[model samples]
Target chain A: MNKVMLLVDDDDSLSKFIKICVEESGALMEVKQVTSVDKAMDYLQNKGEFADKSRNPDPYVMLLDLGLPKTSGIDFLKRLKNKKEYAGMPVVILTAMESTENIRNAYCNYANSCLIKPFGFEKTKELMKSVTTYWGRYNRLPDRAD
Target chain B: MDKDNPLVLLVEDNDGHAQLVALGMRDSGIDHELIRVSDGTQALEFLHKKGKYESSQQPRPGLILLDLRLPKMDGLEVLKEVKSDELLKDIPVVVLTTSEAEKDIAKAYEFHANSYLVKPMHFDELSSMLQETGFYWLACNKRAY
Candidate 1:
């Protein structure tokens, strides 16, 4: 089955470049970009209009950005880890926040992985390629229920 | 064994992650033969030779690259299983995932996961990490046959 990769970054340029590179890599990722944490939840849980799996298939992996409007990445992680039902859901913190403190806190909250977002487009593309290569194709993620 | 092949089992769900890891391993030039399996269930199957893996496949994977959050079974569960089984317990299982959750980290050690790696997203960084990881596991550490 084909896989879905979800990203919640407000940066349009970064997201576009990442999407293009990811597609070009031939990994078969259906990239979903949401601007906010609420939308992220909506997409992941298939809430509201996203209920249609055809449009919003539950992602095999989630690359979450730390900074967001209203709710922060840490807050989202707090909520996500708190829920026992979604334990199988592995969250990768893919954000620009690259601090040891942030890394410590994010890990404290039970995030599956924390990735410091790359700065340059080329660097970002390389990061995206490697991350997907390891987790998506090489490593086996948790299986889907459906 | 590919004459000089070192067995490594990788349990990760994402395809992109797998590709980059492959590249990194190649860059490191370790000549480690990698085995890919998705989720915890298949991991168990591979270790035990159940289901599609039915035994008699030469030497077992020398090391395991385990992702913490897996479907059907989580990494912790699989770790516990690997550690518990006397036949497979001796082999090393490395917990390599993106999460740095305190509880998860603590729990991984508690379960006796051999090593833990929080994956770097950038390719260069990841390559370096793979170089280190591959070297440490394949070269530095001694394993039982």
Candidate 2:
């Protein structure tokens, strides 16, 4: 099975970079991108344009950016985790904010893991490779019943 | 301990598994100190600094590798307590177990486990998994503290 990763970030360039890196990392995984928290919710719930479950499979893991235009990523994380249906989904915080407070907030809101967005292209690639290799190959997600 | 090389608290009842973890960490070459507790009660005591762990100079762990089937108390119970505690909630807790049952996986995640990894039957695979786990959690994942 091709493991799908849901990437929720507003930065188009960064998201694209991550998608390329993940694909190049040779981990049999797919990156599905969404620009905002609302879009992410829609994608997860298979609402609106993502109504086809076959085309839009549930992601094994979600990489959420804390900064968003409308609904903040932290708020979305809290909402997603609070729901029993989405509670088991792993949500990894991929953000540029390294503040202890922000990291604490992410964890307090039940983020599965938190990673700081590394600087430089080489560093980012290395980080993404590790992220993909670990989350894609090693981590186990709960079975999603259709 | 510094963030680069933080203490790792390992809660596993099986001595063989604990030794394998030690070997795996050594093989991974990640600089970390592994503190092993045979039961869930001891694990909590170490984390909470109660009983024999009080006044000890060991630094707080940056990561916890928990086994679900633990003696004295269940690993899920320990995870719930740790994650619910304000002081300990931020520390990453990865569920390392042999069981691949869907219910256990769901319950561990529901309790806010940082990650869930099943132990492979093959020795080499287990070691490799441990190596990957150590590198990812200790070196890759950013610490809150």
Query: Per-residue CA lDDT of candidate 2, range A120-140, in tens?
Result: 667777777777778888898
Computed on C-alphas against the true complex, the DockQ of each candidate is 0.05, 0.66
TM for chain B in all models?
Answer: 0.93, 0.96
Measured by DockQ, the strongest candidate is: 2
Share of native interface contacts present in candidate 1: 0.00
True contacts kept of each: 0.00, 0.73
| Least accurate 10 contiguous residues by lDDT in model 2 chain A | A118-127
Interface RMSD of each: 12.2, 2.3
Clashing pairs in 2: none
Model 1 stretches with alpha carbons more than 4 Å out: B1-145
* Residue-level error in angstroms, candidate 2, position B9: 0.2
